[model samples]
Each structure stands twice: as C-alpha cells, then as structure tokens.
Target: MANIKLKGSGYGQFGGFTPYGNVTVLAFALATTALGAAAESNSTAAVKNGDVIELGILPTGMRLEDAQVIITTAMTAATTGKLGFVYEDGVDDAAVPQDAAYFINGGSLATAARLRASGTKLVVLPKPAKLVLTVGGADNAKASDIKVLVYGELTGPK
Candidate 1:
C-alpha cells in the first residue's frame, strides 16, 4: 500500500495556520493497490429526456465516495428540465427502472447558464449507473454533452 502525507507548520489565532511556523498534518493511507488505482470514472454523453447511459460499473466490494455531474453545454433560457444520476443496487426486478436505488438529484437544466453539481455523497453502485433526464418543454437541440465523474475505492479485482 502507498500513503501520502501533507505536513505544514505555524498558526496565528487570527491568521489561521501560518505558512512558516505552525504545524498541520494531513495523512491518509491508500489502503490497497486496487483502491489507489480507482481514481475516478469519467463518462461523457449527449443526453435527452428518458435516455439511459451507463456511466460505469463499480466493483462489487468497492465503496463510492462521491460523484459529480457537469453540464458541458450551456443551457439556454428556453431549455427547462431536470437531470438525475442513478445507480443500480441489484434489487429491482422490473423490466424498466423506476425508483433509483441510489440517486443524485441534479439541478434543473432549465437554468440560463451552465451547471456544475459536485460533492454528491452516499452513493455506492455495486452494479452500474445510468443518467436520467426530464426535458419538460425544452428544445431538443439545446441538449448537449453531459459529464459524470464517479469517485470511489476498488478493493477487489476489477
């Protein structure tokens, strides 16, 4: 296993940790070789409402720490809709996916500007993840590339 440590020193009551004198220590263990290799999964796709795209498949024993979704294409004022991320939990028996076992409710694409949603937590996908969008009345042409980045630990063989 590999480990990274950050050390600094010096602290002033009003200035916080001083760059020169006070001490601050940040350390973390990589845990396993596989975990160190699981940097993140990056998937990009042009998405529309009711469209399902698989982001990635997280190994069975790994734990997803966080996720981020960024709307690469700027949404126009005429574009109005909702975008979401869902991960399969290996339990639903329906032919069609209804309730997302683990989901991150992203911002409405209706915004008149680009959107960046990050730090979504408590998501663990033992299977795979898909993107779901509801583009209410937005112009289909306004839909563009969407990027999903999932961060996690892969403790088992991929």
Candidate 2:
C-alpha cells in the first residue's frame, strides 16, 4: 500500500511544518481497480450530464471510478448507449441514485456520456466510499457482452 500526505489543501506562506500547528489537518487517500465481466443486458440506465455514478469499493480500502473499455473488436454503432467499465461489482445500483447513468456529453476523457460510433475512451473520476462499480449499457443491448475497464481512487476528508 502506498501512503502520502499533502502539506496542506493550499500553499501558505508561513504554514507550520507539521499538524501540531493551528488548523491542523489530515487526509487519507487510496487507489484501486475492479471489474464486471458480462454482456450488456436488461440494464436499466439513463445518460445525462454531470451525473454521478458511484462505483463500489476495494479490499484494501478505496472507491470505484469510470474507465474506458479497450476492446479489440470494434464497437458497433448499433451498440450505441452500451455502457462499459474497467471495474466490476463497483456500481451504485440502488434508489435515490441508480448504479449507472448516461451523460448528454461524453466524459472529460471520452464521451462515455453517449455512444462513440467506432469506440470511446472513458474518463475515470474519483469515487466516493460505500459503492461498487456496475457497468450499464443499452437496455436493449444487455445481451451483448461489453468489456469495461474500471479504475478510480478513494479519498477521505480529515
């Protein structure tokens, strides 16, 4: 396990060298990856903008994030709306917020928000705690198997 502590949230001219000083602060961070191998099936999801799809966790302690699905075979246009992931068992599949969602625009890295005619390179965003990643795809295309690469990190505010 890798460990690191930032001096502070922001740079200060006369900040204390250690946490014993005033406004002491501490933070915890971790990175991990998970997988979900299955064909896109009766998966229920909707794509929109600024949506938060919280993937689950890791054994050591971390969160899940979105990722690009690097497939050797070209993704068919008909496959539009088929969500892919690099992480698995790492999705927020529940009420209040479902496991998967769609963004009107593509992700910061790739347009995972929509279909990439030929393919796509999904962007990985930081995930919160207590959620696993579960890749969603076209509700119609659930029968077709889509390989997703899920990767992300978990950070705690102290």
Q: Which stretches of candidate 1 lie over 4 Å from their true place?
A: 1-48, 75-103, 110-124, 127-139
Which pairs of residues clash in candidate 1, taking residues 3 or more apart in a chain or in different chains?
9-21, 9-22, 9-23, 10-18, 10-21, 10-22, 10-23, 11-22
lDDT of each: 0.39, 0.30
Report the error of model 1 at residue 143, Å.
Answer: 5.4
TM-scores of the models, in the order given: 0.42, 0.28
Per-residue lDDT of 1-158 in model 2, one digit per residue for the tens?
88987677552323335544322111222111222212232324332222233332322222233444433332223333323222243565242232232222232222223222222333323333332222223222122222334443323221
What does the lDDT come to for candidate 2? Answer: 0.30
How many Å off is the CA of 150 in candidate 2?
1.2
* Candidate 1 lDDT (Cα, 0 to 1): 0.39
